[model samples]
Target: MTLYLLIYFIIIMGAVVAVISKKLINSAIMLALLSIGVSILLFAYNAPWAAVFELSVCAGLITVLFVSAVSLVKHDEENIKENRVKYVLLPLLLIGFIISASIIVPEYFSKLQIFSTYNTQKEEPIGKLIWLYRGVDIIGQLTLLASSVFVIKHIFFKRKEADNGGKI
Candidate 1:
């Protein structure tokens, strides 16, 4: 198998591991690692624009979100209300949905016959293509970056008792 495909497989496994992890902090870190793996795979497949988007939005934005949210929850299982039946049933339902989707979705592009012609010409750099053809998408990405920064700063840097005159 190609290295890119292998990386994708590893990312899938990492995501599964992250989802099942007991500690929320560890799961968040694993998700960041999974995003980095996906970004590297996108870069290897000659989609640097996609790679940058995945790196910034998935890795950076998601990590910031996880860190902010994780801080709100106490790191103790006693605080959690576990429902084993619901947990087991949810996974089974999700597996059924994935199986249905796999059966419905086409594996090869030829099966769908969407494209009329394949272009294999040497293309411009992704940055140039972004500015020329996909400028709107680049602008949207910049907006998202700004919004995420604002949210992160609001969550993590807001004034608290520790900053005011309280002892730790």
Candidate 2:
């Protein structure tokens, strides 16, 4: 319970950093942290297959994409300086949402009989279940990943080539 809560807290913190960072590289690193925290939580909850997928797809492949995109972008120091002063509102908002959800979600879930049913559904071997029943979802995720890589490469490559007098 404490361990799970710690992982969730790390997830929230990493997510907030990912959303609010001014630097693209920082954001990508935070996104990796968020993925790692999520994978840890999924593993702790006994969903190792889901954890592995999340770690590989989200933390590994997606982070590589993000870092590549970040490398292709020019960081404007002026824009970063302008956005640095948030006056604590973002922290307050995140804390408020976390505190509220922590209280309400569990209480609400406890009143439902469906959660108990939901728990039993994951008893099958996760690999068999995912490949058999969730094959379409995997295909979709792969398609999305490939498209993102292509788009990022295309856009950045064009921009760089143009900046270099269209040499290559």
Candidate 3:
């Protein structure tokens, strides 16, 4: 219960920071944090498949895409004014969350039946289950990944061309 509350707090704070952040990179990082918190919550709820997918696609892939896009944009960091207090607080908050989670998560998982070592019946292998039962989801995730990569490539090339006065 306490762990769930803490996770919820992290998710909410991350979302608020992501929306209000002035820098694109900060927003992207916050979005990743938010996704990670949600993933942890999903895992605690015994939804491992959903948790993994959320962590991989949202936290991993989308955050990479966001950071890549932000890197492509030209920005003069020296001129942008930022609040130092929030920057300092962010790390402290993360550290506290990590420490608390480490202590609580193991105990929480021990109570879950899914994480238990003993099973009455043998279960299907994870690989076979995913491929056979969730084939369409796998295909969709792959397609989304491919399409996002091409879109980013196109945007980068277009920006370069525009910068070069329409020369590719």
Cα lDDT computed for each candidate against the true fold: 0.81, 0.83, 0.87
Task: State which candidate has the highest TM-score.
Answer: 2
Off by over 4 Å in 3: 76-166
User: Per-residue lDDT tens digits of candidate 3, residues 92-162?
Assistant: 78779989999999888878857667767988878898889878999998999899899979876645566
Model 1 RMSD to the real structure? 4.9
Q: What tens-digit string does per-residue lDDT give for candidate 1 at 1-168?
A: 589768987897678668667678888989999999999988898878789989998999989988788887646555787764664465577689879877777665457687566678987876688789999998898999899899979877746677888732
For model 1, name the residue pairs that clash. none
- Best-matching candidate per lDDT: 3
Q: Which of candidates 2 and 3 reaches a greater TM-score?
A: 2
Better of 2 and 3 by lDDT: 3
| TM-score for predicted model 2 compared with the true structure | 0.68
Per-model TM-score on C-alpha atoms: 0.62, 0.68, 0.54
Candidate that beats the other on TM-score, 1 or 3, i.e. the better one? 1
How do the residues 1-168 of candidate 2 rate in per-residue lDDT, one tens digit apiece? 789879988998898887777777888999999999999999998888889999999999999988987776656533555545573468887689979999999889878756464554547676787799889999999999899899979876645576779876
C-alpha lDDT (0 to 100) for residue 76 of candidate 1? 59
